[model samples]
Target: MRFLAFLLFIAFVLFAIFARWFFICDILNLCEEAPVEVEVAPRLQTLQLTENDSVLLSGYDQFAFSKGIDQPELNTNNEQFLDTLAQMLTADTTKSLEITGRFTPQEKDIMAGFYENMGLARAAAIRDLMASRGIDENRISLKHAITSDSLLQEPLLFAFALNDLPSEYATASYRFTNMTYSDANFPSNSAIFDPGEAFRNYADSVKVYMEAHPEKSIRIVGHTDNIDSEKYNLKLGMRRAESAKEYLENLGITSAIETESKGETEHVASNDTPEGRQENRRVNFIIE
Candidate 1:
């Protein structure tokens, strides 16, 4: 009996030790685990603008923007860089500037009243700002790209190349309002469209319009470039229209939806260039 009592006491002591350790470490927060390392995103250290294989503006702070916004937030360094660039362009008469603005798929086309996409809006905004800074608006060309970087803080990417010089002045207004509607663009020979923030905003606007006109119905017409046979293109266009209809239905639009296909027939732009073809492959929303 004595031996058993001693064994019980030993077990109790061990349990007490473990219980105290657990109470201190787990309950009282006195212990720490291994520190976790976080991965940081790489940022651009320099802002560069080149022309005809030569660097014009270099070693400036990268231009950044607020998340989901098109307006660039310029710091003192950025302003200085711009002032220097304006002076350089004034001195050099042969060189021209091209501003290519970038936008992620998540950004909305808030400047739909002026530009077709957020990327174009951003580029135009920069061009107008430069114009106000005494840079010749005729010497600057605006372009846009759908950026691949999901975590990109700076949405403007700059590069230079030779292009035909024009004498017209830039004429884009700075005011912006939320996009009420936008065309859903598709990739080459693809029917699926990315229902981005612009699409969501358009759906919301449609919902409002639909509530006011309950008897009105919605129509989605899909168009395609001249790529394949007429029959095949028609079928592809129909698929594209159906895809848009599905997106609208998922976005809580209860109005009657109609789908049509105008394959390679009605195009807003010439189908000669790749950019034109991309623009041609789109689905337009119409209220009927």
Candidate 2:
């Protein structure tokens, strides 16, 4: 028995040495291999901007100049355009504006940074003007692109599109007719969904609509009353939205659903009254 034990110990040591020398070191490709050459596609060769039906600022000759928009140089046309944009934005709280700066292909090499900077500056200038005219700054987005089309004489183009929905969805005639649940439907300071029959019916209706229209997307926006700090309210609002999203997902609604928290910033009612505060803590479903 002792001789057998000694032989077993020797076999174990030999196996360990073999493992370290051959299996660990040689069998496993621990050594660095030669680097491989990969083919990469060239960028800036194609123009990504597409022509859309929604045109807010079209053929504005003022933006054609290389210099940024000067406040003094804004002519009657510019002022009228700004006024109309501000009015449109004021009328629709869900609408947002996008400004794109398009540069000619010839100028791409000479003024790459200039085109980008000018695009942002132009959008910022327009946003500032709109803000001065009583439109919120958060309702605007800015982008820059280089277009090979020489026909685009204007350096900047403005388009007004829905904030949450794609342009195609926005133009569709279908409307979401279901009424949203009020704050009373949910438990106090909780995001858990203990749905009554009415709430379940509403969710079913939304699910049916979404299943029929797979292309459409919905945004569940949650709002809270001004009871706590803005940070706490924001988190609570997000939780509420998430709760709604989970409920909808469980209902087999296959369409894309997103959640947003407005906190106490976008209140539907005055926070002074108890009734008003209750009304403020609600969720809104925006179909896109």
Candidate 3:
């Protein structure tokens, strides 16, 4: 029995020496496993406003959304970053934010109520979050883009600008055109001018011209349809012109702006039809 016990002990020792490696390498398969790669998080890029002006948002990555989700999943650091942005906006009243959300074509497009697509909805969601953090909603605009990159790491992009939208209507030579006031342009019988994307281009050109030739001045001639009395139309037209002038001035134009009212006398279209009347109610910007 003692010899049998000694034999068992020998067997146990042999098992521990020989079987241990096989247990780890063959049974567990740990020896065949490859080294896991650590993924580095993407850093948030700086927001460039101009040649000299830029906003550096350190320690924050771009916000990302889940598949088919409009709301972004923001982290604690993201909240802090937004707080800092809100404070910056509060201090500087002349700056605005443009949030552009990007999406892939392969993803299903989901409409979030008024937003036509998930791209726009994502942008609006971020804008609303910023607005909730004390930034004025009006100061924030939303844009969306479709990307072919299905592997886009981060989906949202941000742009900080000088409180003005980039105009696409810039021209080499200046041509004075009608700043139409109608359903398509401004509210009926109101001085409020909601400048379209095209109009913004013209406004930008005006600024460039004023900067290049400081001696040049602008003349805004306001015209109206024959819906109102002559005196009332004249007043309305003058108000329209003044509104345009004020808009240009806010765009950093320092040149003098003279506003006048042509009333219903200069009707480019007939006032008989709705479309013609709409066409007639406009202001012309003449550079002098």
lDDT per residue as tens, model 1, 79-146: 89778877877777776777778887776445442466778777877877888988767677665677
List TM-score per model, in order: 0.46, 0.39, 0.42
Task: Report the Cα RMSD per candidate.
Answer: 10.6, 22.8, 18.1
Which tens-of-lDDT digit does each residue in 1-288 have in candidate 3?
999999999999999977988898989887766889988555454322221255456436667677778887787766776788788789988877767777888664454443435676787788788879888776876666677767546577676766554542211111232223233457755788777655676677668767989888888888888896999999988988898888988899988889999888877556788856765777777777
After superposition, candidate 1 runs with Cα above 4 Å error: 1-43, 108-113, 160-276, 279-288
**How much is the lDDT of residue 21 in candidate 3?**
82
- Candidate 2 vs 3: which has more TM-score: 3
lDDT (CA) for every model shown?
0.69, 0.63, 0.69
Per TM-score, the best of the predicted structures is 1
